[model samples]
Target: MTIEPRQLPAAQRTLPAMLQRQAAEFGQRPLLRVAGRSWSHADAAAAAAIRAGALAQCGVTRGDRVALMSGNRIEFVEAFLGAGWLGAVAVPVNTASMGPQLEYFLANSEARLLVIEADLLQRLHTADLARTALQTIWVIGEATGSWQPPEGIRLVPWPAGAEAIAPAAVQPGDPLAILYTSGTTGPAKGVVCPHAQYFWWGVNSAEVLGVGADDVLCTTLPLFHINALNTFSQAALTGAEVVFESRFSASGFWPSMRASGATVVYLLGAMVPILLAQPEGPGEREHRVRTGLGPGVPAAAGQAFFARTGVRLLEGYGSTETNFAIATAPDSPRGGVMGWLRPGFQARVADADDAELPAGEAGELLLRADEPYAFASGYFNMPEKTVEAWRNLWFHTGDRVLREADGAFRFVDRIKDAIRRRGENISSFEVEQVLLSHPAVAACAVYPVGSELAEDEVMAALVARDGSVIEPAELMRFCESRLPYFAVPRYVDLLDDLPRTENGKVQKYKLRERGVSAATWDRGPGAPRAKG
Candidate 1:
C-alpha cells in the first residue's frame, strides 16, 4: 500500500503541538525508554514544557536558534522538542566536530545558547567558547559541570522538572531544527528543516512500516541525523515506543535488541557490512526485529541477513534536505537500488541543462514535494548556496542515480564523490560495491586522489576481515579481473580501521588529504603520484 502524503491534523503538524496531543491521547504509554527508565507521552510533554520555560529563562526567545550537541538520550530529545515548543530552532551539532569546525557551526548558526552533554565539553575549544553570540551554555548531565565559561556567557545546569506552561504558538512553516552536513568541497552548512517536513516524514514512515501502537522502534544512530530524528517522529506518529542507544555496538547489538524487545531498527549502508562481518553467534537469530529501514545495504547482504534472522532490510534514498523521496518495500530487491518513488513527490534524472535523462542513464537527481512545506526550507545563512541548489525550481540532490522506466531508482554516487580517471567518470560507489562483494573485504571507502596530469586517480582504504588477511597485490588482482584497468584502484591502503563520524559515515576528505601514505601500495607504472 503506497502511503501518499496527506494533510495531517492541525495539532500534529508541529512538534510541540503533536506532543501535547499525543500526551492527551496516550498519557501512560511510554514514548521513550532508556537505561531501564521510561518517559511516557505525558511525562515527556510536561518535561518539554518545563525545558522550554528554562530556555526562556536563559534569554532564548522565539525564532532564536539553540545549538544542541549531545549523545543519543532523552535529554537530546527533550531539548529539541522544548526549543520547538518555544517557537525556536534547535541546531543539533555533530559531536565528532572539533575546534574550528565547532566554532564555525556556532558562528554560522548564530545560536543564542548552547546545550551540550557534559562528557562532550572538551570538544568545544577555548576559541569556540569565546564566541559573542553564544549567550549561555546549558550542560545536560551535571549540575555543576567541569567547563567554565568566558565572561559575558552564563554556564547553567540543565533544567529539571518544572510546572508545565503554555507552549508558544507556532505554524508548520516555522523552523524546527537546523541540521549541519559536511560538504564534499567546503565546510558544513546548516539545512533549515521546518515543522511540517518532520510531520510528513512521520506520516510516510508510519505508512511504509505499518507501525502499530505496540511496536517499538530502536535506533543506534545519534539524533543529529535525519534518519534517527525522523525515527523519533514516526514513533510519535504511530504511538509506538522507542529505544535509542547512545552508540552503535556491533558486538552487543543482538543483546541490545533482545533486551529492548525492538521490532524495528535503523542503520546506514556501511553498517550492513560491519554487522555481517561480526562472527556469527548462536543468539544472532534470536531477536524480535521484524524489519530494518535505511540506505546502502547490499542486495546480497540484505538476503543473507534475512536468512540469518527473519527481519527484512528495507532500502531508501534521501538526504537532510528532503523527506524520503525514494524507498523500497520489505521484499524489494536491494543491490544499491533505492526502490520506487513514493507518491506526493516528483523525481527526475537529468543532465546539466535539466533535461530528463533516459532510463538507465545516470545523472543528477531532482526532487520536489507534491505538497507545500514538505521539504527543507533552505540552507541557514547561506542564501547563495541555497539558491544554487534550489535553482531551476527543483532541489538538486547532487547525487547521480539511474531511474528505470517503472520509476525505480538505483543510486550511483554523489556527484562530488565521482572520480575522473583519464576523462572517464568512475563511480566511487561502484568501486566500493565491487570491493565489498569480495569475501575478504569487510568495509572500504573509495575516493579520488589528484593525478599529475589533468584528472584523478582511484584510491581505496579497506578493512580486511579477521583471520583472512588480504594482501594488496591479491586484492589488486581481484579488482583488475573485475573492473576496467583504469577504474581499478591504483593505490590501496589496508587499514586497521577507517576514520568515521559519530553517525558512521566515512570521512573521505580525511583520506584524500592524507594522500598517498607510506603504507600505500602502488600498482601503477611509477611511485604513487602525490600531485594535487
Candidate 2:
C-alpha cells in the first residue's frame, strides 16, 4: 500500500502557539488536575506565561535550555510550558535518576537555568560541581526558606501571581524539549525533538486514537517521556480534560480511572502485567475508559485484559526519537503484532547491511515519514549519533522485527539484546515471552551474557509469581519444549524484583551491571539445576 504524508495545521507550527490556541478554545475547561486541585485552560496558560515572564526576569532567554527536576506536580507543568512560552527548551530530568546522572544531563544539555522542586534543591545544596553556567536556580514549592546557592549560582524565588506575558514567536523547527532516551544500552542521548514534530504527533495521535473534548486522559507515566507528553498534548489540542497522578499504583489504577472519569489513558508494557497481578474484582470493567494505548503488551495478556476491562488496548511501536511512528488503529487486529504503519509513515525490514528484507523475514525495522514534521530533528550535541540513526534516509530503529504480508509487524527483539552463540542467533525477547507464559513466572528480562564459548550466552532474570520458588531445571525444560535449543537460557537468576524506570521499562543496564554470576543464582525450587 502506498502511503502519503499529510501536512500539519499552521496553528501547530510552534509549541507556544498551540498552548495559546488551547487556552483560547478551552479557556474555562479544566486543563490540569493534580492532587484534587483543578487548573482551567486559562488558569494553566496564565500561570505558565507568568512563570515565563519570571524566568525572563532571571536572565533565561530564547534558545536556552532550562533543566527541570521535580516529581509529577502542577508546578512542573507550569515550568515546562513556561519554558516553551519563553522560547527555551525544557530538559525534564528524571527524579528517579541518581545525582551523578542528573549532573551529567545538566552539564550535557548546557542548561542556563535549573528550576527544581524545593526538596530536590535542598538535596543538591552540598554538591561539589561548579554551577558556573547555571545563572539561576529557582525553587518551586511552598516553604521558601533562605537556601544558599552553590558557588556562582543565583537563587531566585518562584514568583507568585505573576501576570501572563506574551509568548515569544518560534519557528516550526525550534527545539521544544530535549527528552533523553532511557539509557538501557549506554548513557542516555538527548533526543532533540522540535515543536512541529510534537504538535503533529499529538494532532495525528488524537485523530487516530479518537481523543476529544469530553475525554479525560489519565497518565501515571512520567512527563519526562514522550508517551506522557504526547498524550498530554493530544488531550490539550482536542480540548480534553487531563488528570495527573504523582505516580502509578497498580492497586489504585482501576479506582483512579473510575474516579477521574478517564476515557483514554496510556500504559507501558510492565504496567499491564502489574495491573493484571492485582486482586480481581467486578470493578475492573466498571470504568469509562474506552482505550488504553502504548507498547509492551504481551500477546498472552492482551485478549484477557480486553475481556476483563472492556477497554480496547491499542499497542504501538515507536521510540523517544520517533513519536508514534506506527500504531494499531482502534479497530485493527489485536494480539502479538504492533498493527500496521501509521498514516504518513513507511516501514520496512532491513538486514544488517541495510538491504531491504523480503516479506515475513526478520530484520531491523527502518521507518521514514514523507514529511519532516512527523519525526524528531536529531540528538542534541551529537551529530555523529544523529547521522548514525538517520542513515540511508530512513530512521533505523534498533529493534528487530518481521513484517507480515498484511503490512503488520511483529516485534522480535532489540538488535543489541540478540544473543550470538555457536553460530546461532537467539532473540532474548522471544525467549522471555515463552518463559513469561509459564504460570509460575510473574515477570522476566532476558539478555545476553558474556560466554566462554561464544560472543554471548542467553541469561534470564525472573521474578516469580507471588515470590514462589520455581526450580531452574523445570523452567529450563519448559523453555526447551517451546524454544529452539540455541535460544534456551544457559543461566537463570531469581530476583526479588526487577529494576524499572519511571515509565516501567526494565533497566537492562542495571541488570547487566549485576552480571550473570552464581551469586544471583538461587538453588531453591524454580532455580536451574547444574548442567552435566
Candidate 3:
C-alpha cells in the first residue's frame, strides 16, 4: 500500500492537524524510532497534544515563538510539534552555537521561552539573555544540576503528563518556523518557513525518493538542519518510519542502519569521503538501504559507494531559502551532474542584469516555484535585505550552476561571499567581523579554501597591528570561544597588507587564489609546514 499522505483530507488544514489525522489513519504504525524506543503515529500525536497543554500551562500563547536547542532526541520533535499544536512558531536553535552566537539567536528571535538539553545549559550564561524579551527556561534533562539561569529569567523543568488539549486551528500559510540561516552581513537572519512550504517539501521528497509505508529512513542529521526535520515530515506524509541519531559517525553508520532495519538514508557534505575511508567488512552491503539523498558527493566517490554497497546515491541541490530545485535521478545520465530541474519549478542561469544565459553557460541560478509558499517567504526582520535578494521577482540563489542541453544541471561554485563547511552555511562577513574584534587584528578578510575532505574550510588572512605579534594558536582560541567550531578558521595567514582594489575594497578573489601560500600560517591538523 502506498500510504498516500493525503489519506485524511482534513490533514490539509495544518501541521498539528495533519499529525492527528495521521494518528487516526495509521494507528500503531511506528512514526519515530530513536535508539531502543519507538513512538507510533498515535503515540506522537497524543504526546504532542499533552505537551502543548503543558506549554499552555507555562503561559504559552498562540503566535509566540519558542526557541528549541537540543540534539536529535525525540524530545526535540515533541517540543517542536507541541509548539505548533498551540499555533506558536517553533524556532530550532543550532546546538553548536557558543556564547555570543547563542546570545544573538535568543535576542534576535525574541523568543520568551527557551527549551534546551541540560548538558547544553552551561552555554546559556551572559547578560544578552537578560536584556532580551526572554523570560523562561525549560530544561529537558536532570533539573538538579549546578547550571544557573540568567537574571530575571525563571527556570523550570519540563512538566510531566499535562492533559491533551484541542489543537489550535492552523492555516497553510501560517508561519510554521523561523529557521535562522547565516546572513551575508550582520547576524544570522531568520527565514520564515510556512506550513505549506514544509508540506510540499515533504511530499515532493517522498515522490522523488519513491518512499512508501514499508520504508524506514535512518537519519543521523541534527534536528537543527532542515534536512533532519524533513525526515519526519516526509515520513508522516507517507507511512514510513525514521530512526534518529544524535549525530553521524562513519564507524557506527552501517551498524546503526543494520540494527534499525533502515531502508533509506541521507548524507551531507564530505560524508561520502569519510564513509569510504572506513575498511569494508562482512555484511556491509547486506543492509537493506536502497537509496540516499544529498549533494556534494564526488563522481569517483559516488561510483565507489555504489560499486561497494550496491545502493544508489542520488545528489540534489537546494538551500534553506529554496527547497530541492535540482536533483539527479536514481539512474542519472552522468556521474558528476545534479540532474534537471524538478517539476513545477522554473530555473534560469542569469548574468548580472538577470538576462537569461544559454545552455552550458555558467552563471547565478535563479529559481521560482510555481506554487505559493513552496519556498521561503523572506528573511525575518530584514525587509530591505529581502527586497534586495528578491529583486526582479525571483529568489537569487547565490550559487553558480550550469545547465546542459539535455537539461542536466551541474553545480559550479558559489558567487556569494559565504562559506559552507561541514554542511553548515557560514557568513564570511560575520566571521571577519569576529576576527576584526580582536584588538591585535588591525585588518582582516576571511575566505574559503577548498577542503580535500569535502566543502571549503574557513581560512583567515589578516594584517596585524604594527606592534602586535598575533599567534595563530591564540587567534584560534579567541575564535573557539566566540564562534562555532565549524566557523572557526582552520588556516591563518598573517600579512603586512592584503590585496585590495583601487576603490579600497579587499580583493578576496586574489586572496582565494593565494590560498595557503608558503608564508601562510597553516594551523590545520596534519603534517607541519614552514611559516616562511
Best by TM-score: 3
Candidate 3 lDDT at 493 equals 90
Question: For each candidate, what TM-score against the reference?
Answer: 0.79, 0.78, 0.95
Runs in model 3 lying further than 4 Å from the true structure: 1-3, 6-13, 143-145, 525-532
Error of 3 at 518 (Å): 1.8
Candidate that scores best on lDDT: 3
Residue pairs of candidate 1 with colliding backbone atoms: 299-335
- How far residue 351's Cα lies from its native spot in candidate 1, in Å, is 0.5
The lDDT for every candidate, in the order shown, is: 0.79, 0.75, 0.83
Count clashing residue pairs in model 1: 1
Candidate 3 lDDT over 329-413, as tens digits, reads: 8867676887779986899999999999999999999998887777888888789878877889889998899888998888899
Model 3: which residue pairs collide? none
lDDT value, residue 379 of candidate 3:
82
Task: Mark the 10 consecutive residues where model 1 has the least summed lDDT.
Answer: 523-532
lDDT (tens digit, per residue) of candidate 2 on 330-400:
77755678878877788889998889999899999999876665688888988988898899988998888
> For residue 388, what is the lDDT in candidate 3?
76
